[model samples]
Structures are given as structure tokens and as C-alpha cells.
Target: MPDRNSALRGQRIHGQFGNISKEPGVTFREIKDFSYLEITLWDWARDSLRSKLAELLGIGDLPDTGDSQRLKEGRLLHLADGSLAYLGAAAPADILEVAITPEEGCVVPLGHARCLLRLEGPKAVALLRRGIREDLRDTAFAVGQVMTTDIGGIGVLLLRPDTAKFDLLVPRSHAIEVWRWLTRRAAPFGYEVL
Candidate 1:
């Protein structure tokens, strides 16, 4: 039998956000505690696949206006040809896959393939404006809106689920560079890693 005290399988595959201060200001951190899954539906399978996923995940009808929906505080990320969902820390891809099949869509595990970072607080928008050229005014990019744009020259999926917050998703390879760029730009205003 496996040692009960030993680290569980897949534990090390998860990312880490070390030593973030709680001091306040623009608090940012890599979200290392959630499960990420991407559901890519084949062209002809889109409608049926979405219905099945909606039923299984208990996510009521998907959003039609924006590319994301705040479901129970988390989110269901819609893409041009697929969708991504964020689950609780204890939720595993296997559990998500149980309700899915190859005929409908493909379930991609993004836990190690991508990194999600969350920025929130008073200066969050300003901090992001330093890098992205898009108009980020509250009226322009309201909560529950998601757009794919370049930040610090890196292509990223930006989601605004709250007025004072933003979530950025980038490839794992570019996460560190993006984090560095964010902190450097945020330095003008007081910031704390959370």
C-alpha cells in the first residue's frame, strides 16, 4: 500500500506561487490550486457537446454574449471553438472526464500546460494598462468579459470577472516572464503578492 504520508500522485505536476505578501494594494498571485480543463468540441459536435457538459457540470445555459461566465464565483471560459472550466482544488480532471467522451469533444488537461494568474485591487487595471494597448475602461471591459490579447508582448487570455480584478492565462513557458513584467509595471503603485 502507498504510504499515507507521502505526497499524492499529480501533486508535483501542479504549479506553485511562493511567498506572496498579504499587505494589500494590487494583490496578484499565480493560481496554483485549481483544476483546469479545456473542452474542444468538433465543429459538428458543438451544440450537443455543450448541452452534455452543461448538464454534467451543473452550469446553466452557457453565456451567449461574452466569452466567459462567472459560475458560482469560478468561471466557464468560452473560446472560439471550445471552452475551458475552472474547478475547485480537490476536483480532478478524471472526474470531469467521466461525463465526457471522444465523440462529443476532447478534454485537455491544462494543469501543467498553462498558468493562471489573478490580479485584484484598486490598481489592477492601471497595472494592466501599462502593458496592453486595448481600452480597458470599466465601461469597455466589464465583468464577465474575456478577450485574447497581448500583454507585455505575450499573447494571453484576459478575463475580467470583477470590476477591480483581472485573470490572465498564458502558456506555462511564458508565465514567469509575464509575472516579472507585471510586478515591474505594478511597482509604481504599492503591490503585494497574495
Candidate 2:
């Protein structure tokens, strides 16, 4: 795996922050280094490339739009635009090596440009509710669901892999602001940096 060089390299990294309850209700961690590849078809609705897109990425029967599924080597997310985002520990050539002429689709590597933060613990739900206006109840936002939303006016890609876990994909430039926002809200419940 590639060495982890996080966008949030500095600032309040590891160590407990905010209210120190008997037990921390939240634990925040940055997903060190991960691969991010986006495959967008020129004409998704009716394009020959759509069929081969999955083959190129080595994913079989891609997840439904707005849903994410784990792959043998990575996690697959089907975005709202009928595109696919694959995140893994390392970048593979399956999609990267494809021709992907302009007539087919576009492949984008976003590993170095985005910051991935994971918030876990019982209070994670409550903490996220304060910023994201979306309905997060288990019934409303099921696991493996991914959506684009905003927190503190910052655009974010929200992913719910489990009940008490949420992964936020934020732009590199605004990661600190979002971290501060999360820490501030989590203070009341007590948070831990791991």
C-alpha cells in the first residue's frame, strides 16, 4: 500500500479533543491513503461504453445509483450522475490502463485531491444530524448509501457503511474547517481522535 500522506497532515490530528466523558461518544480518524477513480460515461443512458465501464473497473453488476458496495480490491460507489467511483488501498491499472477515448468516457484519479474522514461511535449519528439536513435514520439512509451533501456550506460526499459509522469525502482545501465543525459539535458528547 502507498504511504499515507493525508491532506489533514497538520492541525488537531491524533489525541482526544473536546468534552472528555467517561467514554468518548465519537472517534474520528483520517483514512490514511486510498485510491479514488471515477468513471463517467459520455452518454450513460445509452452508450456502449456503459456496458464496458464495469468490465474496465473489474466490478460485476455495479451497485445501484447512490449505493456503494465493497469490491475484492476496493469499494465501489455509483454516483447520482450514473458514474462510478472506486476507492481502494492502491490504484490498479484495470481502469487506469484502459483507452477510454473521449467518445467512451472519462477516468479521473482523485486520490491526492480529496480528504477522507471517518466518524464513528454511538454519537456519530447525533453529531452528523447537527450539520447534514438529510434524513439519517436507519430506515431513511440505509447502509451502503452514498450521496452528495454539504456541511457548514462545504460540499461533501457522505457515505454510511454502518449504523454508527460515516465517512465524509471533503475537498482538500476545506478539510480543516469541516474537522473543526465536527469536533465542535462532538465536544458536547465527548470525542476521541484515533
For each candidate, what TM-score against the reference? 0.77, 0.88
Relative to the true structure, candidate 1 reaches a TM of 0.77
Model 2 spans > 4 angstroms off: 1-4, 44-47, 55-60, 92-99
TM-score, cand. 2: 0.88
Best of the candidates, lDDT: 2
For model 1, residues 11-111, the per-residue Cα lDDT tens digits are 22233233335444577766766556776677788788778767766778766544676554356777665655553343535566666678866787666
For every model in order, what is the number of clashing pairs?
0, 0
> Residue 60 of candidate 1: its Cα lDDT?
81
Once fitted onto the true fold, the runs of candidate 1 whose alpha carbons sit more than 4 angstroms away are 1-24, 83-93
Enumerate residue pairs that collide in model 2: none
The C-alpha lDDT values of all candidates are 0.69, 0.80
Residues 73-155, candidate 2, lDDT per residue (tens digit)?
Answer: 76788886658787766645354536466666677878778889999999999999999999999988998899889999999
How high is the lDDT of residue 122 in model 2?
A: 91
- Any residue pairs clashing in model 1, and if so which? none
